[model samples]
Target: MSQARPTFQPVHRTAKMPKAHTEVDPLLDALGGRGRYQLLQYFVSKIYAFTAAFQLLNFVYVARNIPHTCGQPNNISDIFTAIDDDAFTINNSDIFYDKCSIRVVANISGDAETKQLPCLYGYSFDERKELSIISDMGIVCDRAPLKGLGQTLLIVGQGVGAAVLPIFSDRFGRRPVHLISHMIVLALGVGVAFSPTFTVFLVLRLILGLFQQGIVLTDATIGIEVFPTRYRKLVAFLSNIGWCTCHLFLPLVAYLLRDYSWRILQLGCCSVSAVIILQFFFLEESLRWLVANGNPKQIKRLLKKAARISRVDYQHVLDVYDSLHSGHEQLDTKKEQEGTLSKEQADALLTEPVVHTVDDETHSLLDFIKDKRLGLNVAVLWFIWFTDSMTYFGLYFTSDALAGDRFVNVVLLIVVQMPSSVAIYYLVDSIGRKKTCIFLHLITGFGLVGATVVRELMGNTGTGAIISTAFSCFGFFGIFGAFGALFFYTPEIFPTNIRNVGLGTSSAFSRFGGMLGPFAGLLSEYVTWAPGAVFTCCCLAATAMVIVLPETKGKELPQTLSDVKGWYVTTDDKRRMDSIAKDGDADETPGQHGL
Candidate 1:
């Protein structure tokens, strides 16, 4: 007879304590036996890395299309213009018609100005003379309006998607929703590459925006739920790094394709999207979701496949599963007398009032507004997102606006963030999320205010402008910490069940600020220093609001609406949690997070 195959024993869903109950470990248990489980852990890590890469592609593509150069594009120096002759340098002074001219006051050679000859660029007599006046001023802009429309559509789509994501995550499952959303964006991105006219391209970009919204929110939702609590900060740090990398990639693309058409930029983005789409096969359904669905066998198979891919030995994983199994048994035994909700009933409780664990709908937007606790948290976060986004985009765009080689300056500005991102990784959890957020917001506000003051007081000379921009950039650097902390903090504010809905709603609201941030930069040109002051005020207001919010530094994740509504209510005080496990039927699916 063949040697007996080694038996496979799956771990249990809930953790057990010898004397009482403990938390569930479905996710840890799902890894199954050791050899296979270790492999699965490695596979999950790659999936996360792939997600970051995909998000980075979006930021890089945006920076490329919207050139950071000070003036607009013109036929003479625009992307389409080419070298007429290698021997002769461009000097169109003799061919000028007043308006379409660049005066060469003196010939500057070897850092010395000589009155040898003055040259002009452009022509006097031509069929395009009238059009040339506007064109020669570098007047016929392409990227601004298109970029604004695209950004707006994206924000609107984000709002809509955030509104519906709770329902979607529940109905479709996290991984499928994430993959399908990315595929939608991939298809629309190709449309962006091939768009013949500006009008059609704008429409396609809007649709693409909608898909982008779902992809991020869903992916974030999954990332928060799947990772153990100890590892959540790692997700935030990695996401920030990915975001900062996009800035660096922008300058690289700008430098490489400075003379290339915008279509080439879109094509590059599409290529990245295509690669991300291919990685979807490796993406796994959140193990947390599997427990909620009561599919232990499926979880086992999923972990086994991960083990094969990750190349880890099986025994180590088996040991973890056994520990979790024993823990769950203890938990269930203790709960036998206390009671528990049936799985189907638990699922329905998610949207129900009062059930908290992934199933509680503790508060809606309306409820949040009415309840002081929920209302204050929502208000504070909304402003945090708004201020963080505005300052972040403003600094990046302003760096582009200042006089310098857009590529190098943009790249260096992004490079400064490498240290900032690393810093966020170490401090986010150590300092406590609330403290980190407050500290960064206050620093960012002061820095922006200081930069604006320096610019107004010193005037716009090269040295002064550069100095001001440095302060502005530094101030913006602090905003990254504020932003990274917010993602982790926001989802924790609300109870588990409606956590996705609350975050999605808030993110959608917050993204409106992102939509406005670009336009705010545009407005800065006409309004002078007003935008800076307005931003400073917004940051101050946001900081004040944040200071007043509660600290969740050491609190365990709440499991039910009762947890939120009755945080003070306890059976030890002699009143049971009213045993919602049956009558209230709180959903136990597990909470989801959104970005």
Candidate 2:
């Protein structure tokens, strides 16, 4: 048998070299690797934040609590006579309640008994100061409920946008949706100023809320995407400074125009948005989105423009694009080979499929919750968003009801948020996302609790207000810092494919809290401390959840659920990728549409 076996000659072969493959990481390479393009996007995006501040907080003045009481036109001789400070007090409570019914000493059945009656004369608001919708329509007594209603509607609209618009941004494109929404906000905003009645104003405000929320979220999300990973916190901090600037500037606008109508204030705020139109000239569509959608032509044009402005070599962008295309083609070829051959044959050929990327799957809100770790993280982030919103709006709304000159005190409360951005610039990076969240939420909680205690100890005295304001200062700083860090962290944690959904969903939860804030303020009717205590507990609860959250400090931004779970690529895939990235030369026009 051995002799019968044919002698096999060793085949002499030429030693031909295998082609080296090349791969390009878009977020790490391409235009983002350069600083100037990232900064340009940041500059364009942050400007929207400034204008947005005016639209968001204009309600502070629009439905503000002016000095209003039941009109006394019939009782001419004693317009304000013997109007006991406690005339409108309810249920033997020590708190003053003058917004609704008026007290009248009457003679029923020849016996004198004080009875509460509807304000027949219509409430007369203070004419010595700024006018509002409440002033014009006399929104008092039976309409006292309407004041809080308007604010709630505005917040509800934003919640609706959060639930809906991200889907549009995902399906259509961020640029068109963002621009269109901004235009809607601007047009409706001006209409809010010229609104002839409270009904009209409320309707206009709802529409304005719908679009303005989209503008801010999309603009900020685009900024987060285009920036270098290392500087995400810094970009967020700077973007939010516009909010602080608006706070400072709004007080000055309020103080200067104390005698003006609310309409004028609304118009003034809407005008700032006109500057945003200039974005059409310079702002580039998100390159990440462009590539994902498989529009390399657009990507090439935008990247070349960005490269020119950023002083990067345009040839380098072309090289990167071509290289990525080649690698993809090579991967495709290997996939075909693997599909056709047996496992042993495939191993002899040395090939496997590529790891899944974000664009491979269809993204939706469900993706955030369907995955276990992501679901838990999303739930925790949702609670944090809810608590953050409740406390922030609670304080901003409550500041108006403080003992001192409300306008002046509101300005002071806003002044406190100014330094928070500066602190977050360092805090987020130094201590990491989880630690920063815990520390900030804890500080905010303790600050609120401190405020409640101070008010109780010192009563309504000016001294108590000062002490409480100090506590509020700490609270605002902590909450604002938390916001900046959360904005940066939330986007980084999610993959690009569903980032808009993740952020929008989180914001929707925040709006739910905001929608509840006005209702929560109603708790003060039962007991003044109830609202503060509830939100403070919420903040502390956020702290507890945050402590258990995973840290995302200086890590490569996760582009998929597997990446979030810290999975590594198989050895074969890794080696193939390396070779493809190094040696592959791609056709310039690979006609594949991205997700």
Candidate 3:
């Protein structure tokens, strides 16, 4: 027996293991990173942004107040007519005739006792160049509040939609949610135009707001997911430009339609939805979403299409899929060899040869809350979104009060933001997301505070007003830059699995801020400096909060909860060391694993 024994040699075999799901980034890179396919998706997403801007701000023109006076009583028609016809000849005693109340003098005597009465016959609006909801629905005087209520409810619906719709996007898919939202938005936008009553208009506006958010949230998610990390800042800048273009275009449309009915303007705005037809034909589902949600078939289909359109080798994409498929087989074989695979598991694996399931645990809002590090990140982002949105919409709502023509002031506000958006395009990639955010927040805070101080010191003179407007524009520039940066950064921080949910939640908070913005602008009516002061404080607070958040520039998009955990090293490292120690790898050092 001893003589029969022989020496044996050990052989090493190299197995091609499947890469992490996140490694799809490389696969995409090979398929031509930021290539034709990505650009096409980017442009399609921008179409939604373009139309949304028009719908979002159309209320400003549609609900503007026009010059009006109380309707004249039959008994005093001659007196009021003369007063209206000869504005200079009207005395102080005739002033009430031009207001919500009318002065009734007994017997038309010069010394007759006069009483102030509400406009009993309804208000008579002046012949103005433009018609508005104020004139059409008689939302004047006591009903003026209804105009603001419509706008507020629309924003509230946006908040609710942001909170809810993206959950479906995460669970079902981005493409279907995006397309369906666009269809609903197209329908609702037209419905808003033809609404028969003010009540119907308000309700439709609210629902329109909800679906509008769905389009926005999904489009942004798809836009970010499709492109490579290198192009995210550029993508964000282009989106801001699209938004600015719409703003510039909308005012022109409003001016041209000045003599037309609000319905005409609304219907014209709805025309932009025609782009949805093209989207249906061209837009593809997000590749990252497909990969994370365990749809290998869809991933292969999308990648192949991308390869065809992008002019990359088709076999490269197939090779990537094959690697993923091979990884699943190896995992199953090991499980079976270890006797951990049940009979049913082995049978299912044998039957479903191509389906490579990653972690099957579904995530929810609870995942965000239960995870301490993620929860902190989400809370900080919520606060930042709330404040940034509040300040942005607040400044916009108060633009008419600036020193220039109302239309010119709004256009200037939007134009000023263009430079900031361009600046952010460079700054975000250069200085990093956190620093860019902090710098922009400081600019916003300082600019707002300066405007408030100048307005207080100069006391409403023309010079003071001009200087204040400039400073406010400066603040607007900063806020717009910050807004773009936030949109770019938010998706990067959250992992692919819950990216839409995280963004949707932050947007929900921003919508709440937007809902409050009109009221914050109203604060200026009572406390002249209050809105600016409050906005400055918010900017400062957000700046401080931003310091604690992680920077995501140059990092590959995280694909799962485990990837997100790496953002906090102290916590993740401790857990990693514990797991390794329990697994009998006590000699492994943190540095060896690149922890």
Q: What would the per-residue lDDT of candidate 2 be over residues 1-595, giving only the tens digit for each residue?
A: 4665432222111111112222124533566564688777767766776567777776777667777766665554232344443432332322222556556554445555565545556675667323777777767656767877677788888988887898788677777878888888888988888887889988877877878778877886787767656767777677777667666776677667667888787777777788767777767777666655667788788878888777877888787676665565665665456545543564544433342223344555576577665678899988889888888877766643344674776567656777778877778889888888888888888888887788778864588887887787788888877877788788767765577777888888999888776666567767878877998888888888986566777765555444543322322234444444345422211111110
Per-residue lDDT value at 21 in model 3? 41
- lDDT (10s digit) by residue, model 1, range 167-277: 566455677766777777778777766666656765776666666766666666665655555656776776677666655665565456555445565556565555454
Clashes of 2: 13
TM-score for each model: 0.68, 0.79, 0.85
Q: How much is 91 displaced in model 2, in angstroms?
A: 35
- Candidate 2 has an lDDT of 0.68
Best-to-worst order by TM-score is 3, 2, 1
Q: What is the C-alpha local distance difference test score of each model?
A: 0.54, 0.68, 0.77
lDDT of 3 by residue, 1-595 (tens): 5685332211111111122345556666877888888888878777886568778888877777788989866665555554453322334344366567777544343454455667777777776523776688888777777878778888988999899999899888898998999999889989988888889999998998998899998988887788777878887888888888878988888888878888888988888889999889998888888878887777788888889998999898788767765666666564444344443443344344343335444566667667776788899999999999999888877643444564676587777899998889889989999999999999988878878888889965689877777777788889999998898799888877788889999999998788778776669889988998899899999999998788888877877665565556433465665565456443453422332
Q: Decide which is better by TM-score, 2 or 3.
A: 3
Candidate with the larger TM-score of 1 and 3: 3
Worst 10-residue lDDT window for candidate 2 reads 586-595
Task: Compute the lDDT of residue 23 as modeled in candidate 2.
Answer: 19
